[model samples]
Target chain A: MENNLKKVDIIFEDSDKCAPLKVLEKTLKRTADDIILDLIDSGLKGRGGAGFPTGLKWKFTRNETSDVKYVICNADEGEPGTFKDREILDRVPEKIFTGMAICGYVVGAKEGYIYLRGEYNFLLKGLLKKLSDFNAALKKLNVDFQIYFKSGSGAYVCGEESALFESMEGKRGEPRNKPPYPTVAGYNSKPTVINNVETLVYTTMICHMGPEKFKALGTSDSRGSKVFSVSGDTPIPGIYELELGMPLHDFVNEFGDGDTKAVQVGGASGHCVPRKKFNDTIIGFEGIPTGGSMMIFNSSRSMYNVLHDYLEFFAEESCGQCTPCRVGCQQLLKGIEAVKRGERPPAYLDDLKKLTGTMKIAAKCGLGQSVGNPFNSIIDNFREEIIY
Target chain B: MSTTEALVKELVEKNGRTRNSLMPVLQGIVQQEHFLSEEALICVAKELDLSAADVYGTASFYTFLDTVPRGKNIIRVCKTITCHMKGKDEVIKAISNALKIKVGETTHDNKFTLLSANCLGWCHKGPVMLINDEVFPELTPQKALEIVEEYAKK
Candidate 1:
């Protein structure tokens, strides 16, 4: 299996061949329904941590009977351990814009926006230049759609789709009540479709290469290659597009420091798999899913410090509107501190575990629900590191 | 009226007079003034047909939009997991000791304000710091202090 490690490059293959304008020109010839059908058959999922089916999201938004629908590409890549979107934006921004334009064409929307994070303000100038070039090409091809860019003001919760819409609307970046989802009432109460930067790039690929060819890459559950931002305690710490469903042990053997003890699959909100379970863990939807953040830790690192860093991040970034998230994060962080300082009994951690489970069920959105993931996983795997 | 106020008014006019333009308008004002002043927030609120509370709520929600005054240059040290494992703590300590200020404080000379940020998205080159818009990655304690001293001279 190690000798036959299949690595595929669908999104960041090359600039000219995957050029946005060229891909758009080819994709625009297909009817809207055909494009949507191709996406549906591609078996692609949102690469922004959430494993939601990408085709279903586009289909829902396209079927909505709204005259003023909107398409947004979520470039607010604020997840602490994730940075593949940043690399993508820097290398092949045209592919992202092209993907958004294709979404606009299929979903019957004329306007699109890329809600970029504020830390990435430096990228604005170059991305705008690319957008203008894409727009000029669109005009030559007589495409009616236009794409705009919005800069987010450094809020992590705004990475949430509804909160992103709110931030784009010049309001506080907070999550909205979900029943009338983004597909029904979003971005000024119009039916909207939002895709992650990576997801949209794959959309372009599904259009360029037929869905059957695209689906032939990864396992049955997870299709296509995933661009992982591998950092922390690795010999080669950079971007890697690996076939999904690869075992964690195989991944560590290839990229690890040879002293790898554990891996944090995904960002702060993702799960932690210890070395004992590395062979059992698969890097895909069927096993331990991720948003392409693989932070490997060796024996020298302390799991206590790791958990503290993640809890602190969640405490700072939680959008405080909901009680379970706002207060629950504070309690969890404080609880971990007490445990590390020997102030709280080990039984106190059991209570904290119960609290995190409550936060998972009661919190308003994904942010609150996922804050407990790392908290529970780290505690479960490294209780010794915490107590001693 | 002050030139700054007039310039802000012009920006509000240029971006358009709508509630949706609130973020861009605030971002523009912060870029020029380094922080959002009370008068500017009120002015933005009035121009965008939002209350001052609304403007303040939105402005304070984002970490980049400072509600209070900041130093001439903002130095953000990345403290995410990768950077932490790469000895970001030592780099942060070097800057603090060199500047004679703590993590969340500004230099008395008002030249640099030190801050700890979560993942500047340069984890590949671990232990990174962003001085204003420029990223300095693969940093050590000595290199971090030298970078601070270089900025201090400026």
Candidate 2:
């Protein structure tokens, strides 16, 4: 089974010669539309867990006729259980900058910003050194572009693109209303293309390797490789880059502890697949898509505790701008505690599920919309453990 | 002028007096003062031409920019699922016991403060804690307390 595993190291293929910068020079030779078309052919989706087509996002930003445009690399890796971006920023900071530069050239953006999370403030000095190196390289290549970094003040909601914009503008990191969308109006109301750190790195890869080779790695619906942050109960708990559409069972066979009971894909906002469903689950767009967090849980772990921890996180992390997300998170956390304490009947969970459903639809942004994912999944899968 | 007022003035001058420099200015204040004083917030608001409420709301919204004064050494223990599964509670308890204060409270000597953080992005090395800027991962209760003691002494 291990023999069939394919590992691609396009992002991590850094040499003394600076591979991504060389690729960016090659990519700059192509027309803007041609580069966007190459991305479309590659079929790469946003690695930010939303599965938005990368080419479509770029094309929209590229097509916007604006005097000012911005490219932002979302380095706010705040999602619990996800740490792949942190590694990328630490090891190959230049690759991310190169990717952002390429996006700027294609989208007609002259300025870019990387909104790095505050928890990673320690990485500021090293990343700044890399940025200066990248800027020097850009000057040498005669590219008229610049990159900047904004350190977030420890808000998880800032990971959202609009909130990131607000944070960068020196405001509370709250998400803005869509429809103008980031493509038409973003980052001081200019056309902005905000791509995830990993997504931009992958863009560099697609540009260097060509669409055909990148597409051939994963399934049709989900193309290219994904880097996963594996933790909990696994003998080897670290980052692993694998083909996008690999089955959950296969991943478990390779990384899970022998007594693995469930795997939480995509962090707290993601789903939990139990042992029985691992065979049917695939880690890609067609199955359970992830933002690169794969936390394995063994038999010794309590499902209720896992669910409780996630609820607590959501409750505290909710932006409190919307009532549904703010109140809904607290209620879900309290409701589960009530069930655990035998204060409420197990059937009362149905009402909480209905509340989560409301929060999913009624909340303004992704934070509120997706809280129901882990809430419903955990309640439905482990009713006995949660109630009894 | 008071130290708080002087610091605020310096930050405003360094980051510019525009409203768009609010967050960075606030972050700079917090970095220097460890917490944002009411005087500092008001001074920042006056310099940026914003209302005190605006400055307060923005300062309170973020987790790291504490409005209230905390201990000299802040220890943030990870409370996410990966750390929870890896017995993070024991580590939290260890720190709490060593400091003689619960989570969210400062010690009597004002030396250390213990708080639970959502995630420090060190899930792979579960059971992690961030002491100020440094990360200590894969911790046991003994190691966690020992580290706390080492900080408490300093």
Candidate 3:
């Protein structure tokens, strides 16, 4: 057996970079508007694949007039090869809870939900205990807040915001038609603001450091560092948190352990940058979202199987909603078979590419848009491996 | 919701009866046993004042917590992208040779059941062999004996 990646301390070196846990008790005095301003100034963006501005989502949700609003934490991270959220929830449980509490305050929501993924029983066990303790403290402090726990069906599709809302509402985890996103209308048709685990965790930091300091760390546009689950054929392949817009090549060598030929940023929905494009890419929203999953491929690795695995995940976890994703994912997986058999002509490849492009544009949500990424990346990068 | 007559009856037979009793019942019967027996799930549903579909839906959704009884020692072999590309077939061959069972089947002794999952979220550590969630990363045919010995000792 080969020695595996070691869990190291690359991210939290400046543990003092975070808001002190004691600050949560003081938050009861702050109003929702103040919290929103803090987040907006922080330039906080959604950490859950999309990288949409978190403060903008909150502003939209806050604009909706609903007394029965909700603040949902999309902790149901079913992204293939991603576990950065798991570590944050496991290690910094207080930050997530505090972030949720801040969301409850900012959005004027009476109720909050931490929709944890189903396989995370180990994680939930610890979180549940922390919630209990936090609740008792809150009750003593007379803070009017309540966050409930809802488990998911391990479907990667539920990672999408609207679909997660549907699951939280006790329905099948299928994507909802958008225009009125989670902000204007969400959970139970109520105005809801859904943020990623990291998004919420960072909220505490944003509030503490002030928005300008939070915005100063990463890039000119995107702000702050991101935690990524680095995987594949590498020497050290666990999670690493790096400043946004950090050079991809520097990252690959420093954290990726120098055995990478290609890299897939942003889990299943991410782009695969071949060695040729690796230097040109930066690890942020401007290029492609790292989305907590940074997967590397050594020269010895076969690209064909990687494409197949990602396509299969999309096929199974498409939430069977919106025909484009549900059917498109299946087509991509089956297309691999045709490519393997050399039955697909160059025209056939063009058709498949067109289909993926269609899914990216026309599909219901981020799940559909991101679903075609691996198919497009693999076909573009590794046609030789598919025939071999 | 709380437990019902069927639930209370089972609670007496197993755990206890009360409101908000699903988590404990799930812990007692499902997590410990690996899969909730039909009778156990029905009992849980009846106790929680919920439908069997609701119970089954809850049960099947999570990655952990199986619904049916599995073999004694669970062998979850990673068939994820990296593993597949790196000759997972060879690892599977070794697994099947050692256990004398194909993927998704249990041995005659019911001592081992092999599962082919997409990835254990550990693609970098390809061919991860988990004997009940204890990850054995970058596994090989030769390493099969280590698991064999561990199971034998157990």
Superposition error at B7 for model 1 (Å): 2.2
User: Candidate 1: which docking quality band?
Assistant: medium
> Residue A268 of candidate 2: its Cα lDDT?
93
Q: Candidate 2 or 3, higher DockQ? A: 2
Q: Which residue pairs overlap in candidate 2's backbone? A: none
The lDDT of model 1 is 0.88
Question: What is the i-RMS of every prediction?
Answer: 1.0, 1.0, 4.3
Rank the candidate models, highest TM-score first. 1, 2, 3
Residue range with the least summed lDDT across 10 consecutive positions in model 2 chain A: A1-10
Q: Which tens-of-lDDT digit does each residue in A126-239 have in candidate 3?
A: 788888888776677666788778776446667778777766654456678877777888887888888888888788767665778667677766677788787776778776
* Candidate 1 residue A149 C-alpha distance from true site, Å: 1.2
In candidate 3, which residue pairs get closer than 3 Å at backbone N, Cα or C atoms, i.e. clash? A42-A211, A232-B124, B3-B47, B4-B47
Comparing 2 with 3 on TM-score, the higher-scoring candidate is 2
Across residues A232-270, which tens digit of lDDT does each residue of candidate 1 receive?
888899988888888888898888888998899988899
Q: Chain A TM-score per model, please list them.
A: 0.98, 0.98, 0.92
A1-388, model 2: which lDDT tens digit per residue?
A: 5534566777677775548778889889999999999999999999999989999999999999998999999999999999999999998887889889999999999998998998898889889988998998898999989998888877889999998898888788889988789999999989999999999999988888789988998998989998989988899999888888888898888888789998999999999999999888888999999999998999998899899989999899999999999999999999989988999999989999999899988998999999988888888888798998
lDDT (CA) per prediction: 0.88, 0.89, 0.72
RMSD of each: 1.4, 1.5, 5.2
All candidates in order of lDDT, best leading: 2, 1, 3
lDDT of 1 at A34: 91
